[model samples]
Target: MRRLLWPAAVLVLLLALNVFFTPSFLAIQVRDGHLYGSLIDILRFGAPLILVALGMTLVIATGGIDLSVGSVVAISGALACLRISEDAGVLAAVAPALGLCLLLGAWNGFLVAGVGIQPIIATLILMVAGRGLAQLITGGQIITVNDEAYKMIGGGYWLTVPFGVLIVLAVLAITAFLTRRLALGMLIESVGGNAEASRLAGIRSRGIIVMVYAFAALCAGVAGLMISSNVSSADGNNAGLWIELDAILAVVIGGTSLAGGRFSLAGTVLGALIIQTLTTTVYSIGVPPETTLLFKALVVTAVCLIQSPSFRAKVFRRRGGTAPPAAVAEEKARVREEVPPDGVRS
Candidate 1:
């Protein structure tokens, strides 16, 4: 909970800033039996990112990175859209897409776990090549489909809320159950903390690695479906472009170390919300298009610094009051050294 404070606070501040700009930023209304508001829009549109980051949280927890997730997103969306365009059932399109993503992830795991390639290099290979795969699937053209059932997955409403949000919730719940209620989370952490030690302790670190990579790819697959379904088209070149970076950033913001170990699904969710809200704030405040990325960078940097304990200590030290524990202890030791044996000031 403490770890989540900075991200939660930052999210709140961003939302408050938007209220200043849009005046009605917090106003949520139901129109024609559908909920509508800026906040609702953030949750709906950010659902895909939340899903991606959720998978990222697990992968990073296992001390690996999956650069290919963005490409997987493109490929998944392309293949699913292509199948649907061919008059395939929505189930047929989705199952195959997700299965392929799972295989792609397993391939990456094989390269890293089986072939002993560094994770970065292994995933990078797929990152570059998967785009071509997606292009091939879509024949270098956007595949547009008109399936109402498919659209419901990403853009439709359920119980007055975005169905995408519900999907995210379901995925999050399942992930939490798998990681928290079971032994899977601990095994992953152990593997990440020290692969050799875990192996010596009889944990199948290799299998865990494979499973997490596959899971990450699976999450990206779902995100791809959501993105393409929302738009009713899949662009091999543009679908989920650069989303991996955002997912990594969200994991970091959520207090997950890239070095791998402990993870918090709730924190990751909050981090994703913060990022989406930041995007909303930028658009609401009329930030110039060219400066948008730079603006986001600055804000993110501030939030990260606030979340860093060492950075906070440095700030406190420089403030000339409320010295950090180490500084206070040092000062006390110095005073004791200078004082006389009678406990009086020199």
Candidate 2:
């Protein structure tokens, strides 16, 4: 129940906010056979954050963080837009765009996993320099690409559903499959739980870490493509700006602690949805657009605090009058197991 509390709270908060701000926010329409409005927009815009959070989950599960993702998004979008502008064949350019993303991921992996650098510090270098690379690609200006292929990636739809959202779902499905069905979650948890122990156990901990970082870049690449498609242009300075904050917030809000350990893809999805809903609620309630971010930050901070062990315990104690019997028993059992017996077990 403790593990479930945070997510459940967020769900209720989402519903409440929707009910108060937009009466029809939860109404899913199949009008002309299409879903639309704020709800759909929430899902659509939240897709990229969902993708980023998926990769962040793996990286965090490995006891690492990738700050380079926002920059990677900028670079990928800039490069792809530039290529299409050059009139390079669609496949020819997109292939290289993807290759570049993969290579960037590899570079991040090499630095953090192979060179023995702190993940945050290692990714920081790219986070700073990568934007400059993107600026160079776009000649310090937003570049518009009138490519049909690129448009399909961001703006095209299938059966009246957003293709970008579908892509995000596909990535989510892949992540869920890999982590849940393949025991990858166990491996990641083990690695994050104890990197040295994993190394001693002959696990390819470094390789795993590298793969996670690389996957993060790949995720960022997809986000960049979608963002560029939506605008029909790439702005290195603005594309995915501050998205790292949202990604990290989503992960934390989903109950994936930043300190690292286990991860939940489903929780991450719900987290992204929560964020989008909150944003929608804020906008619908007529808050100034500039203040939207301030509100988001405050809400995220509140979530992080609530998820903190100390805070949760405090809250639990304050509400102890209504403590559930099952929870009390579980707490007692945990205490007994944690404490040594009065005498030796033998």
Candidate 3:
């Protein structure tokens, strides 16, 4: 509960602001046997980010990053749509697209795990080339599909709630079970805490690293399917542009260190919701389209500053005085223990 304070507070603050700006923000009504409201829209639109961030949490926990998720998203959607456009059955389309995603993920894992490439550079290789491959698959044109069954994945409602929300919930539950309910989470933390030490201790660090990267790619692929299905089309150039940045931001804001170690899936979900709410709030407040990005950046920066312990400490020091000697010593000790000798950024 203590670990969740910042993200929870940020989420509440964003929702309160939305209520003030849009009186109907909290109102939910049943329409055609389905839920409809700003809140519902936030959850629906945020599902993709939630999925992507969940995978990212694990990758970051392994002291690695996957910059190619956005490109994988594009490639996933493009391949799925291309197959569908060619009269492939929906199952046929989905299976092949996921298989491709798995292969793409495996390739990334091979680079970082098998070939010993730095995680960033290894993933960046695909980040740059994957989008080009997506373009090639679609011939630089959007491929549209009209299959209702496929559209249900992203746009349909079930039990009066958006299907996308259900999908997110299911994935979250499964991931939590896998990571927390078993020893897998412990092994992952060990690897993140100190890869070489864990390796010597008999943990299969390489296999864990490969698994996480592949999982991140798999999540990105699912998000891609949702995005393409929502609009019934795949635009390789625009499908998931910059979404990787958003997922990274969500992970960081949720208290997951970029340097790696512990993580919280619930916090990541809240962060995603806050991001989605912020986007909706910007439009509801009638911020000019051209300046929306600027507004968002300002708000995000404020949130980050508020969440930073160092920033808070500095502000408190200016207002009052320094911490007791014991407290300062403890803080320094904790930092020294947590940070690696290589000066890895957290």
Candidate 4:
């Protein structure tokens, strides 16, 4: 709960800012039995990000990172759109795209786990090559799909809520269940904490690492479908571009350490929302398109600094605050032990 405090606070603050700038930011109206508002738009646009970050949380938890998710997103979207353009059935289009995503994941896992390449390098291989692969699949042109069913995956409504929102919720629920209701979370954490120790203890660290990478790719694939389906086309060059950075940022902002160990799905969700909200806020405030990146970078840096313990300590000291109670006690204990009771130093 405490770990989620900063992200929750930041999200609320951003939402409040939105409300102030755009009075209708929270206004939702039902038209044709479907909810509509800026808030809904945020959720809809942020859905893909949520999926990507969820997978990233697990990979980061395993002390590994997947830099290829953005590429995977492109490949998945391209393949799906290409099949649909070729008049393939919806299931036929989607199944093969998702299967290819898994194979891409396997390739990443093989390089990292089996071949012992560094994770960043292993994943980077795909990151650089994936766009080309997507371009090749689409013949360097945007593949447009006229399939309404496919578009529904990214844009339609259900029960007065965006279908994309429902998809996000379903993914979130399933991931939470898998991590919390089973030993999978523990195994991943163990591998992250100390792979050699976990291996000694009979945990299949390699297998777990491979599985996580594969799972991350699967999540990226789903996000690809959402993105391309939303637009009814796959632009291999631009689909999911730079999203990997955003997913990594979301994972970091969600209180997950790059060093690995414990993680919180709820935190990642909030982080994704915060990011989406921030993007919306930028547009609402009319930041120049040319300067938007600079503005966003500044805001992100501030958030990261605010979330840094060392930075907090510096701020606290400048405000005339002492160490925390536990730190004070530990320091006193150390001093007492260092200076013998009768003034005799050991």
Clashing pairs in 3: none
Query: How many clashes does the backbone of model 4 have?
Result: 0
lDDT by residue (17-136, candidate 3, tens digit) is 889888889999999999999999999999999999998899999888899999999999999999999998888998888888888988998898889999999999999999999999
| Best model number under TM-score | 3
Give all candidate RMSDs, comma-separated.
7.1, 3.8, 2.7, 5.3
Residue 36's lDDT within candidate 2 is 77
Model 2 lDDT-worst window of ten: 337-346
Least well predicted 10-residue stretch by lDDT in candidate 3: 323-332
- Runs in model 4 deviating more than 4 A are 323-346
TM-score between candidate 1 and the true structure: 0.93
Residue 228 in model 3: lDDT: 96
TM-score, model 4 to reference: 0.93
Q: For each candidate in the order shown, give its overall lDDT on alpha carbons.
A: 0.90, 0.80, 0.88, 0.89
* lDDT by residue (tens digit), candidate 1, 4-82: 8889999989988888878888999999899999989999999999999999898898889999999999999999999
Global fold similarity of model 2 (TM-score)? 0.89
For candidate 4, the per-residue lDDT at 52 reads: 96
Model 1 lowest lDDT segment of ten: 329-338
